[model samples]
Target: MLGILVQLIISWLILRFIAKTSMDVLGYRINTTRLLLCVGLLLFTTMAALLAYALRWWFGERWGMNPSFSLLLLANGIWWNIKSVLFEELIFRGALFYLLIQWLGAKKALWLSAAAFGVYHWFSYEILGQPIPMLVIFLLTATAGLVYGYAYLKTATLYAPIAMHFAWNFTNNFLFSGGQIGKGIFVLLPTDTVQVGYIAFVLVQYLPLVLFFVGNYFLLKRFGKVYVGKQHQAPQL
Candidate 1:
């Protein structure tokens, strides 16, 4: 799509002209060992996300068969989720994140990414200016941004973050039909959907995110540091 193309061009321009580095610094390449690592993390994070949705059921909500479900729609939803995830990862964690690390060091850069990601979601998720949703969304997405940024930093590759992001979003949008995209593999009828008390809601909502964010943060920490693709010296700023 033209939008994605323009974003790619913008990222390249930032790397080429502003960062004074080539795309090589992005480390957007494949290595067998790291690819396997990525795949493993991909499965791990996907299960975490799926289990998070499953927690909704534990709190009394129920799903009905999606009336509009079909193979064509499922395929389309998967592709759409891919593009959406790719768009966010590129915007948040691609070239600009690397440039930030170059200019500000990893700690500050990661915070910037986290803050920007959280605020950006305020607009994208359309909870802008609302108190509760805004606060919650910012905290959730910002924490996610930290994990994502760290993944990119430690691996020196976008693939790690992309796989995790795509896995989580795909589970929400496709498997669980939890997104605004359409009826996914299943749907919750309003009549069947149960609204629980604040305590139950908090447990169901925040607990899974805890598993996801905490799972990723520590597991990746244990994965150790490395370059995922072809070894190259960091671009000297």
Candidate 2:
């Protein structure tokens, strides 16, 4: 965490020196109404996707309960998730991304952000050279980056992208116990107990997330033009 803070501080310095921009370029501050709408839109899309999986995988009497459920741990998970989300958003969709737009246009900058995001996850997941897993992980994270970056570009705010990112992570971490964080609200059944075929397993694991990214991508494309008041004034090129 200290390392992340140091990197963030250094990043801020670069953002100031090279871009002449502050964190505001990431669009953290905006009309409260607009922020809420962004959260609502992204959350619904995210939850609907997860719920589709829950219906197929969890609620079919397949996934069981977590024996140990602690409110204290839940609190800790929430705190950690918030910090991690903010850090990633600031890194990927923050100043450097904004500058990429100035140098390259929104389309090219989005691709760069998407590609960097996909590659960064390789180190984060410690899957540096393994071909198969790295490829799969890259595809997933890169697709996510495109969606989130598109949201940022279209809405002119990080609120849009952050909402979607936080939703997917938080739900996976705290609701389904599917994340690296502590125990969540539910747990998946043991593999031995729940025997799913390879095709079913693949669908259960990846399909919903694909639907989510596709849904949000089009949603952002369709309605991201929305804004309210002058609180989120667009950044000048």
Candidate 3:
């Protein structure tokens, strides 16, 4: 609990500072309400988790897989979900990616930021003592990063990507199993059957990119130009 508290404070302070600095550098004012962004992100993430859970329940029943939920488990699940959303967004969406855009051109920045975010996952594998599987994971994670990077770039707000990141984590961690959601209590597929390094794993990892493409298309249609110049005025909410 102390560790979590420390993480929360450090992440908040660091990201808040970074956000402010990036705003100054880019001359892009924050037009949207931060509270609204937080709420919207929470709602979208909840919806995605519920959708994945419902699907898992349906399939698990068909396949005779037992998925259980209890009060304690539910509490832990929520804690982890919130932790993931807040900390991950602070590092990837809010600070690193935002700074990348300010330093590099937006297009090049996206790839660089995504790679940094994706490769950071190796730390997790090392902690778990799992196989590195560098090549496959890199491609997959990088693809996910691209989708997330593109979203933030287009919206010029951290809200949408943060929400999407939260949703993806919640769904993948506690909803389905294997590539779909994850292998939490709500797991759909038992881990034994799912092999890493297979094409399916790569596809599953990169699935968010497909959503990114769709979101990017709509954003482009609505916004026209993709890059936000320093002199361009921020739109009113």
Candidate 4:
């Protein structure tokens, strides 16, 4: 936990510096709403986690434990998650996706960024759980990434995607027990425990997230700015 906290602070400072430097280089004005967005998203994440915990207790016969506000108050825990949101936003959203948008174009950048984000989780699956088939989960995660990326592109602020990420993670970790209908660290759901059928397990577990992405494709396309416009147009000859 302390380790996660330290890592998060380092990530936040690094990303903040990067944002400041990039803004100066590009002559792009700073978005003052960034901090507010972060706070709003963090709060939403907390609420969603609590909601999920309530649902699990009501329907799934899970422990009826109230969501821990203390966890959010815990210095390291809060820092770790906040860092998770900030660092992840900085790396995948701020840096990698931004460059990809400049080079490959926005649509391609969005999809490619999503794909890379999904693929990056391979290390977690392989190291943590012995190389399980995580492609399904990754795909869903990628789908979520698309929405997040779109949010960032639309708002030109880190808050939207940050909030969405925090909500999803908090729900998954605290309420869903890291299980959101896929092969994950948690098995809070009924179908998550099937030992023999891995494929069935994955499909049953993470299918909603997949559908969610598919349904949200339009929003992504809309906010993501699929067409290269004057704002991002090539230099005139």
Best candidate, TM-score: 1
lDDT of 2 by residue, 92-192 (tens): 88777878777776767778899999999999889987999999999989988887787787777878878888788887877777677767878776554
The residue pairs that clash in candidate 3, if any, are: 172-181
Clash count, candidate 4 = 3
> What TM-score would each prediction reach against the true structure?
0.88, 0.82, 0.59, 0.58
Best-to-worst ranking by TM-score: 1, 2, 3, 4
lDDT of each: 0.80, 0.74, 0.53, 0.53
Which numbered prediction scores highest in lDDT against the true structure?
1
Estimate, for each residue in 117-180, the C-alpha lDDT of model 1 and write its tens digit: 9999999889877999999999889999998888887677788898899889888878788787
Per-residue error at 127 for model 4, in Å?
Answer: 5.8
TM-score of predicted model 4? 0.58
Model 3 agreement with the true structure over 1-237: per-residue lDDT tens digits: 565467546645654675554233221245544345535544544554454344434334223232565666656665677676666655666555555665665666777777877688777545334445776667666766776665565556655566567666665565443332234554344333433456545444344445444543454335432443342332211
Runs in model 1 lying further than 4 Å from the true structure: 189-199, 224-237
Going through the candidates in the order shown, the clash numbers are 0, 0, 1, 3
lDDT winner between candidates 2 and 4: 2
Candidate 3 off by > 4 Å: 1-68, 127-132, 177-237
